[model samples]
Target: MSDHGGSGEPTPRILVFSTNNISDPGIDLAGSRHLHYPATVSVLAMPCSSGIKPSWILHALQAGQDGVFIASDGEECAYLPDCAERTAHLVTVTQGLMAEQGLEPQRLKMAAVCSVCAEPFAKYMREFAAALSTLGPRPVTAG
Candidate 1:
């Protein structure tokens, strides 16, 4: 599905899975600061990035998201010490699954977004939006 919004051009939509304690604050700060990012970007708050299911990533892509970004907690996870490693492993697994399903691996990305990383979050969103635009709209499939 494509949302042209009367512009006659398909806009790239991104689904961001952000850690509640670590990344959500930064994302919210970006918004409060009036930082520019694509309006089509949506954020979902999760307790931890490593807890995200691989299936959820595929589901988001298949459900029409042009890309999925994980706002990881990195080495400063409040819930788990090895959260970064676990999240990386899940990202790898999810990418492999995407490849098997004929999806571009670049469509999935992960980065650290600390509580005070408003600028970085905004930058990441802009970069992801550009990358998705270059990839074009995702091909729709019939269920």
Candidate 2:
């Protein structure tokens, strides 16, 4: 992570898993509207949220991401009718795994983002960034 304007505080690095058919458009709309959100966030678009593996989330943290956010399709999913429920279960399972690895459960978050949810997407990012700032950088473990 890089310093925040040389304030000596490390900027949080967030990884977002966005659904291609739903959340991606919302995120794009947020960007197109010039909505303010932290630049530290990096999005990876996938086919669906429910397909995300628990190990992938842990690997993101282990690989130096300060936090992870899942932008789910909710009821607007094109792939599965129960995408929201499945994604919620995935979050729960991943959280448990995170706790077992000594990671804070709050470091992970999830929210439904529809195609027109630009404001909500931006809001989520800002809020997540603030929460991550409060948590500080992910602890550097000695290998």
Candidate 3:
């Protein structure tokens, strides 16, 4: 689903790639309260963080998304130990590539939160949104 709010101007788009059970309550509350900046954020759930292929991130950036946020279960992953670690690595590598291409690596982030850490997740989302606002839209490039 898409959560959008802001002035009429095109808001920075954020793709939230989730690798664990995202707390619906948290999402609802955050969406209802509205973030500090205009944002068009979409949530895409995956079975695990490792399941998120690098190509998906590249596609989002190439498609003009201003930023991407990846959330995983952290060390509490049910399927394996430290599955989020791989996701962290992927984010680092991807961010490096984006930087080399003249993009702001800070636009991409990886957060690890447990199912019960709803407050933290919400906080992270807000901070991320604020950061995106400062960075503004990414420059469009030929794909």
Candidate 4:
């Protein structure tokens, strides 16, 4: 209902952790094709989606990002047999901590993306941004 961005910024900013092997390329493809998503989106590449630490997500939220999106490698990840499973578990644990700390668990999201999934990647970003907007902003401090 209120302004979408947590700090009342006009556009909500999202920090995406994309795995290098799969999701990163998908994101790059989205850009090359000029697929329009939110301009406020920022991406960081990771060796693997399952490698993210809970503190990283907390730090991003504390550092003023409106939301954190995990662009998981899906079944294509070379790092782990169950690529999505590990990240999903991390998200679940992190979300519980967030709720305990009075932060909106909805501020964090995750999705599977393969190397050639540019169109789907764009769609996911659009949807995630809208969801973050609805959740408004996240609290600065973590419990």
Candidate 5:
């Protein structure tokens, strides 16, 4: 197992998958606010919600991340209804699969936020991080 900060204390890792052009300004600010955990969060930007694949999420966990957060501009999806629907469905399915594999269900999460929803999106991220801290770090495994 990897130590949280080289201090030997375990820390949780968070990965944020954001839709392309949908920037998350709150990430750095939130990390600064939550200095206790030392905020081991990484952000990955995708071209769109549809760009995210199930394998990506699985790979993140397998790579030792404790949690994953996906955010997209649902109402502004380029594919409109179809793209939004597909992303939602994929998230639901992914959550189920993660739980089945003994990973924490909360490890996989999805949020629909546009440029205007920055506050709420940040709130969600903070809440998610807090929840994950309570759950503790997940054990890394080799499949």
Candidate 6:
């Protein structure tokens, strides 16, 4: 399914999955701080970044999300000793899945976003939106 708004205007959408322990606060702070980002961006909070499953990312992509951004807990992760590695591994695997489906791996991005990183979170959101704009809509799929 393709979406271009009713007027055919490109309103790139993103599916953001954030770890609740660390990254969730940053998302909240962004709002409290009045950090502005695309209203089209949607967020889902997760208990731990390590608990993230690559299949779900694929499901969002297949469902026509312009891209997927994973907000890692970084050093603040409570469940895993090294959240970065696990997140990287998840990204790598998810990218491979995207590639296998003929999708660009660039559509998936991950970064360490702490609780106080409202600015960084907002910045990255804009960046992701821009990147997705350049990538355009998800590749036309076969029926």
Pick the lDDT winner: 2
- Full-model lDDT for every candidate: 0.89, 0.90, 0.70, 0.85, 0.71, 0.87
TM-score for candidate 3, please give it.
Answer: 0.78
Compose the digit string of candidate 2's lDDT tens values, residues 56-109: 999999987889999999899988999999999999999999898888999999
Model 4 CA lDDT for position 39: 75
What TM-score does prediction 4 earn?
0.89
Report the error of model 5 at residue 94, Å: 1.4
**Candidate 5 per-residue C-alpha lDDT over 36-136 given as tens digits, one digit per residue, 9 for 90 to 100:** 33357678877777778888898888887888888876767665557677888888888787777788788888887675565566677667766877887
Candidate 3 clashes between residue pairs 3 or more apart in a chain or in different chains: none
lDDT of 2: 0.90
Off by over 4 Å in 2: 4-8, 140-143
Clashing pairs in 6: none
Residues forming the 10-long window of minimal summed lDDT in candidate 6:
1-10
Off by over 4 Å in 4: 1-9, 141-143
Clashes of each: 0, 0, 0, 0, 0, 0
Task: In model 3, state the lDDT of residue 134.
Answer: 80
- Give the C-alpha miss distance for residue 97 in model 2, angstroms: 0.6
Worst 10 residues of 2 by lDDT: 1-10
Superposed by TM-score, candidate 2 places the C-alpha of residue 62 at a distance from the truth, in angstroms, of 0.6
**All candidates: CA RMSD (Å):** 1.8, 1.7, 3.7, 3.5, 3.8, 2.5
Worst 10 residues of 3 by lDDT: 1-10
